[model samples]
Target: MTVLYGIKNCDTIKKAKAWLDNAKIDYTFHDYRVEGIDADMVAEFFAQLDWQNVVNKRGTTFRALSDDTKASLSAETALPLLVEQPAMIKRPILVHQGQYHLGFKPDQYAKIFASA
Candidate 1:
């Protein structure tokens, strides 16, 4: 089963969901805001993706963080932060067949599914 993780109101997540629906791909949307995220799940993402790739540095959530929090960010520090504040993570993280893809683009999704 394919699992898509992100916040519901994010524009990127909206676009990704639309793309998946249009393509008729079956996937379960894991809305971090509504469903919440856990440390183990965040760790799983960290195992497959770099902290830099998973963290959304440009988002408001990250910007609003304390300077100490931003400066001290590391795998250990980020795990709890991500679990507590899912908005700090990037949107539309797709996990399929044990493979993980961060972010989304039509062509990228197409290639990923084709390769799968």
Candidate 2:
């Protein structure tokens, strides 16, 4: 099974969910706002995927971070920040089997899911 992790209200997440449903793909949704993500889980995700892929620098949540905080972000710094703020991580992290995908792009999902 695949796991789709993101906030329920995010338009990107909604699109991702709808795409998966339309494609007849099964996925489990993980809402960070309601459930609150864990540091350990973030750390584990980092371990499995590249730090750059896991972090969402383009998001408003990232832009709103303190300059010092954003400037000092190394992989180590990023992991904790992402844990404390799940929004810092990219939206709609799709995990299937042992592979991980960050963000939701229709073409990208098509490529990935096609292989699955």
Candidate 3:
């Protein structure tokens, strides 16, 4: 099954959801902000995806961290942080056919779902 992970109220998540709906693509949205995230799930993502891409460095949540914490960020440190603070993760992580896609854009979504 395809899964989309992110905060439910985020604008980028909204756009991604809309695009999926318009394309008639079925997806299960895992709202990390409210429902919480699983460490194992994030760990799986880390194994296959870049830690830098999974951790949203540009978000206010990440920027608000202590410089030391930011500096210490790695797959090890970021995993627990991500599980504890879902907002620190980039928006709309689309997972399909066991592949992870980070962020959102119309063209990106189009290509990601082209095989769906």
lDDT of 2 by residue, 1-116 (tens): 89999999999999999999999998889998888888788877788877878898988989998999888888888977887788888888899876888888999999888977
Q: What count of clashes does model 2 give?
A: 0
**Tens-digit lDDT string for candidate 1 (3-107):** 999988899999999988988899999998788889999999999998788999999889999999899899999999999989989888999888999999999
Candidate structures ordered by TM-score, highest first? 1, 3, 2
lDDT of each: 0.91, 0.87, 0.87
Runs in model 1 deviating more than 4 A are none
TM-score, candidate number 2: 0.89
- For candidate 3, lDDT tens digit of each residue in 1-116? 89998898899999999999999998899998667788898898787677788898888989899999988888999999999888988887888998988889999988987777
Off by over 4 Å in 2: none
lDDT at residue 3 of model 3 (Cα atoms): 91
Best by lDDT: 1
TM-score to true structure, per model: 0.95, 0.89, 0.93
Residue pairs in candidate 3 whose N, alpha carbon or C atoms collide under 3 angstroms: none
